[model samples]
Target: MPNIKSAIKRVKKNETLNAQNTKAKSAMRTAVKKADTAALNNDENAKELIKTAIQQVEKAASKGLIHKNAASRKKSQLMKKA
Candidate 1:
C-alpha cells in the first residue's frame, strides 16, 4: 500500500530481487547437501561434488545472497569433509 509511485516501484523491485536471492540460496543449500552426501558415501566423485559446492557458495556470495565469510567457511568445511 505505497502511496507514492516511486515507493510502489521500489516495492516491486525488492520483491523481484528477494525471489532471485531466495532461489540462489536454495540452490546453494542443495549443492551443499549433495556434496555432504557424496562425502559421506565415499563416492569417487566426492571431490568434484565438493568443488561444485564451493563454486556455488562463491557465486551466491558474489551475488550478495550470502556473506563472503560464510561462503568461505562453508567451502572450507566442505573441503575438510571431502
Candidate 2:
C-alpha cells in the first residue's frame, strides 16, 4: 500500500486503467476470433466482420493497449483470410 495520498490515488487510477485496457484487449481478441470463424465458415458477413475487427484492433492500438505493428499484422492477416 502506498503511504502517500497521491501515490494511493495513482494506484487506484492504475487499477482502473488496467481493467479498462484488459477489457479492450479482450474485446479486440474476440472480434478477431469472430472474424476468423466467419472467414473459415465462408459466411457472407465475413467481410463485415473483418472490417469491424480491423477497426477494433486499430482502436486498441490507438489507445496503446496493443502495439501498432501488432495491430497492423492482425489487420493484414485478417484481410488475407477474408
List clash counts for every candidate, in order.
Answer: 0, 0
Native-to-model Cα distance after best TM-score fit, residue 16 in candidate 1, in Å:
0.4
Worst 10 residues of 2 by lDDT: 16-25
Error of 2 at 76 (Å): 0.4
lDDT of 1 at 16: 97
Model 1 stretches astray by more than 4 angstroms: none
Query: lDDT score of model 1?
Result: 0.94
lDDT, candidate 1, 1-82, per-residue tens = 8999999999999999999899989999999999999999999999998998999999999988889999989999998997
Whole-model lDDT per candidate: 0.94, 0.97
- Model 1 scores a TM of 0.92
Q: Which stretches of candidate 2 lie over 4 Å from their true place?
A: none
Tens digits of per-residue lDDT for model 2, 40-61:
9999999999999999999999
lDDT of 2 at 18: 92
Worst 10 residues of 1 by lDDT: 63-72
